[model samples]
Target: MKRYLPLAALLVSACATEPAQDLYAIETAPIPAAVETAPMVGKGDKADDPAVWVNLANPAASLVLGTNKDAGLYVYNLAGEELQFLDVGRVNNVDLRGDLAVASNDETNSVSWFTIDSTTNTVSHIGDTPTNKDEPYGICAGLVGNTYYAMPTYKDGVAQVWAVATDAISDGPELLAEIQVGQYGQLQLEGCVFDEANGQVFVGEEEHGVWKLDLNDWTAAPVSVDTIDARNGLVADVEGMDIWAGENGEGYLVVSSQAADRFVVYDLKAPHAPRGVFTVVESLDGAIDAVTHTDGLDVNSAPLPGFPNGIVVVQDDGNPESGVDQNFKLVDWTLIQAALGLE
Candidate 1:
């Protein structure tokens, strides 16, 4: 039931001075969202990033965790209905591996931990541990072998890796190493994703582009996978990133072209060639508005009710309603693959 749109032949070339639209070419037709979550309470530039939690037992019962930078975290169901909202104070970027959900807590200047209870369809706050970086901006977590590492990135272009012991959430998220991710005159850094299959992490330096860091050797210099270039479909201020997991490290790395209101896909393997560029337009039925000025996004390949091939959830900075606050939109992943001609 995947819908394949006609591909456009006009690819974006290098440009010295042009409008934002000309900076990144839209390679495919506009993709619409299948679901949109309830708007957050805190108005104006509050809703930031989102993380999806899959339910193996019941796919329809999966949950989406979103951050309200002015408030806390909001959990919603597959239908985009709010199930619960936790006012944990300025919880920014969020990510999850297995059942452990973690977020960068700006209020406490630490990394907050939460345990996912699938049976009850809820995320319970366990505790938080202080981070070396003050007021961590973005975070992504994953298990390297058997140990869980939570990486909290800062506004000063620095990132720190902390190992968390799940059995003892309150014990310690021992600080392992500190990394200076600033390169290419990067003063601000946020939005990151863990590539567990490759034993590496991708960090977004807002004004520059994405950098690939080796988790094994923290001292190894970061490699530039791609940068803010019009030819590669990236505009300045690159934001949220997530992986569409595939077999044996075969997949696509989706990064938010924040300034262009589009998402750019690159080959998940070495070289990281550009695959395609797309934007989420208003729903066909006009129920949900287009996603613009997105901050953070998460993609899951697990089959869900309407999203048989899984879905990508992104923060919608602008809601169409007169007074409704910002929210997140859900797009079927199969539509993206077909539109982008991805395998």
Candidate 2:
């Protein structure tokens, strides 16, 4: 069933003249608990993004790939144990498809890739693709039939869409499309996700807002789904976007509000339509701490052991327990959905 937000949501967003949620603010959702936590491999501040590779045969064995911006990439298990660590320079963001994973190698300003072995729960650094940009920030996968595509966002607000193959096609990726994102002079861009089911590409503009373009036609103009300035529910520096696919062409577009330490949820059908914003607060079960200053995150609908429906992996910039650099937290999707009253 197709789900659409109330008419009021569209009316308010059309003019962009009033606050989206004046006094009508969504309450914080209890995070329940952290299933697992993967800390950054390097000593400095790392653990920027996470990409989960589901082990279809056994959901409990799924592998989570995350980036350590200070050093390299890390491979972890569903239990959050570090399986492998491949030092391939600084990788900012990463995404997985089939047996391949692509990343933004900020150290060399190129696209780094890996071959995933679900059985071993490890990823081998295969090759690198130059992004042709000074610094590549975020990266995600796009698919056309059996073919794979890599979409990388640069620090200059230029996002390059490419058709990439994992089997020794080339040392780099083949550019298929390119679009310069972000608004005003906000060149810094990050947090992007490809709606493989839908025909859209959603990306975050740090100091500006969230924008989406047609996945089939990148040359087309983009539509601003949401924006942030001084007075609004969304705080400055909009970051990290993830899709929670639901039944019947329905889901949510979750965005990380860095400055406010809250997460905003939007209807998947009408992404521009506001749903409700929620923060990860302390759980009554007293299992995990609240999440603050999240950078990159990912979610899956597949059911697992602890999370029957699925789970969300979010990079926690603050590690209060160890007082370390950063780490990624695994949250139960069922609790989030129940709290938000999302079907």
Candidate 3:
């Protein structure tokens, strides 16, 4: 009986450690029946990604910079008015560094530089990064001290993090470190971000899960921290990622599951072992593609009135022929908070 007692206790503990079933079940409130539709800047061009720049003087009036895949970057006002477009055709990812917006062209194997005039909401093409590899998908900028770190999706199955100075753009991004992630058949690397506060960078592989690497020690290889399986109606092709900090400067990691038409949220307070995966349902009417394969996300602090904190913006790859409506959607975090019982 004593031996049986020990075995029973072990089984109970194992079951207790398992993630709660309801963690992945998201209770979503219907987005207002009338979904606001933004105008498409160009035809046959999918609106890929977006970043927000707050107008400090007038928080009510902010700017959103969106990537028009294969066309260029488009700037829009808070009311979704198209301000301007700079044609530097890029197919992959786009990001901002101060007043400069950087775009990666996977097919061309290049990154383009542009200076954005915030006041006028215009972008000027400065130059392009010396080309490399076949497809450079994921690109993000992180400030380490005074230098800016640029990460580009590398071909041949690895991603390179570069240390770029003002002049380093012409010579191509300098190799700071390389992270080799497991490949799925022939699928390549996709979404990535550097969390400064955590002193680590998160990289997402198309067919695999997300990985975490410590920048303090570049030589240290990345380890798989989370595995996103295609279960519970969650999209298997994970693409974009963005970090949201809580009131105390600690928060969650939000990732997109392109095929399943959902976004998964993971609590990052535990670092190694993340908890709670919440799904956000895509608007059936606004889905740009047959599947709400959402790509690219940017969270703004204090975006709308009353909601002083902020909101998240996501891109829809409108494939109307297949029942997808190409457009961007503003996700009210306040609504998310209420769903998570935070409210």
Predicted model with the maximum lDDT: 1
Off by over 4 Å in 1: 1-21, 24-28, 321-324
Model 2 over residues 1-343: C-alpha lDDT tens digits? 1123357876777679764653223355556446556566345567788988888877778888888888898888888888888999989999977778899998998888788776775689878888777788898887667668888897678889988555534546678877988655566789888887777889888888788979878789878888775333465578888888877757888888776667777887764576666666545666556677778988888888888888888887766443265788888888888887888
User: In order, what lDDT does every prediction score?
Assistant: 0.85, 0.77, 0.63
Cα lDDT tens digits for candidate 1, 13-56: 22325423345444545799889998875557888999999988
- The TM-score values for the models, in the order shown, are 0.91, 0.87, 0.78
**After superposition on all CA atoms, how large is the RMSD of candidate 2?**
6.6
Per-residue lDDT of candidate 3, residues 268-332 (tens digit): 55554443343344445654222245788766546465345577677766544322446665666
Arranged by lDDT, best first: 1, 2, 3
Q: Which of candidates 1 and 3 reaches a greater TM-score?
A: 1
- Runs in model 2 deviating more than 4 A are 1-26, 41-44, 165-172, 229-232, 282-287, 321-323
Model 3: residues >4 Å from true position, as ranges?
1-37, 41-45, 154-156, 166-173, 183-187, 230-234, 247-249, 272-291, 302-307, 319-325
